[model samples]
Target chain A: AQTVTQSQPEMSVQEAETVTLSCTYDTSESDYYLFWYKQPPSRQMILVIRQEAYKQQNATENRFSVNFQKAAKSFSLKISDSQLGDAAMYFCAYRSGIGGSNFGNEKLTFGTGTRLTIIP
Target chain B: EPEVTQTPSHQVTQMGQEVILRCVPISNHLYFYWYRQILGQKVEFLVSFYNNEISEKSEIFDDQFSVERPDGSNFTLKIRSTKLEDSAMYFCASKGGAGRNQPQHFGDGTRLSIL
Candidate 1:
């Protein structure tokens, strides 16, 4: 079983600044996928970015980037030039990448989530 | 951009009653899933469906819970006998069949309130 952990319960960043949310996971499987999801006041779970365990280079999507350390089992999200819109609950999620009987049916395991607040 | 859409943004049912939450996944998606999140808690996977049958399910998904793709477009999750603890936000997600690693797109979830 894979478990995701987000140690930070709450985080705040000043507008236009940068912020990093930490996440770690314990998985015996070598192949897997990591993702960051954002939930705003609307309560919609939106995918922010994703990283593959095999990729040595981190994944970057505009202002959102990830620091993935496979050896350490750590995957963190960094938001640059943060804006008020970034204020939301962020969750770290994990999914198996192995292909077998459960090929496309792999379920996502999620962390407790970190509340991000952008201060003006 | 194709999106998964869930119906009845909110549902209120009495304990021990049956409740069904519906979702319309992306037209081209081949994988469907149901997940739930209690207020102030992390999202938890319930079940995953593929090829019209359930391929995976979690411990939280007990006998009281069922999933069906009754038609070409609708995917439904039914709780046979709801309990107060079942009250949570139910989310529907779908993924394209092109590859196994494709990200799953999620719907805006239905808030299920069991009284």
Candidate 2:
């Protein structure tokens, strides 16, 4: 079975500063995908960024990026120049690659989530 | 951009009552999924549907829970008899491709509250 862990339960960042949310996972499979999702006060789950285990380079989407260390089994999300809108609960999720039947390779195992607060 | 949409942002019902949560997946999406999160808990996958049939489901999806795609675009999840433990935020998601690389788009989710 695969599992995701978010060590930080709560985090706060000043407006226009940067923040990094930590995540780790345990999986025996070699091929997989990692993702970071954001849930705002409105409770909408939004995709922040994604990283493939095979990719050595980290994934970056505008202000959101991921520091994926496959060997360490860690995938952290970094929000640069954070804004008030970034205040939300962030979750780290893991998915198996294609052709894996453990959970249909479609089901996502999510972390406990880190609640981020943006201070003005 | 196309996205998944769920109806009834919030629902309140008495225990043992039957409730249906609705979702309209993206037009081109072939896969649909339902997930739930209890307050302060991690999101858990409930069921996954493709080609009008359930492809996979979690242990949480017991006999009391069912999913259907009655129409081309509408996907629905029904709870036969809701319990207090069933109160949680239910999220609907859809993905366009068959491969696992594609990201699933999620709706705002319906907060199901059992009284």
Candidate 3:
């Protein structure tokens, strides 16, 4: 079984600054996918960015980027130029790859979320 | 962009009563899933449906829980007998075909309150 861990329960960043949220996972499988989801007060789960385990280069989406260290089993999210809209609960999620035992059924395993607050 | 939509943004039901949450996934999506998150907790996967049958389920998904895609576009999750502990935000998600690196798209969850 794969387990995701977000050590920080709460984080705050000043407006226009950068913030990094840490996440680690334990998985025996070699191929997998990692994702970051944001949940605002509206409670909608919005995709922030994703990283493929096989890719050595990190994934970047505008202001949101990921630092994926496969050997260390760590995937972290970095938000640059943070804005008030970035204030939300962020979750790190994991999913098995195509060849894994649970191939056809790729359900996501999520970590305890970290509530991000943007200070003006 | 295509999106998954769930109905009755909020539901309140008595314990021991049946409750059904409905969702309309993206028109082209082939995989459907149900997940729940207790207040202040992480989102947990419940079940995944493909080809009109359940392909995977979690320990949390017991006999009391059921999923069905009764029609062409609607997917539903039913709780035969709800319990207080079942109160949580139920989310519906869908994804494209297998072997692709597509991310699962989620809907705005339905808050289920069991009294």
In terms of DockQ, which candidate is stronger, 1 or 2?
A: 1
Tens-digit lDDT string for candidate 2 (A1-120): 999999999999999999999999999999899999999999989998989898899999999988899999999999999999999999999988854443333888999999999999
Candidate achieving higher DockQ, 2 or 3: 3
Q: Model 2 - which docking category?
A: medium
Which has the higher TM-score value, candidate number 1 or candidate number 3? 1
Query: lDDT (CA) for every model shown?
Result: 0.94, 0.92, 0.94
Candidate 2, after superposition: displacement of residue A74 in Å? 0.2
Off by over 4 Å in 3: A99-104
As for TM-score, the candidate ahead, 2 or 3, is 3
What TM-score does structure 2 among the candidates reach? 0.97
Tell me how candidate 1 scores on lDDT.
Answer: 0.94
- Runs off by more than 4 Å, candidate 1: none
- Classify candidate 1 by CAPRI docking class: medium
RMSD in Å for all candidates: 0.9, 1.4, 1.0
Candidate 3 TM-score, C-alpha based: 0.98
Ranking by DockQ: 1, 3, 2
Q: Candidate 2, B59: how far from true, in Å?
A: 0.6
Q: What share of the true interface contacts does each candidate keep?
A: 0.72, 0.62, 0.66
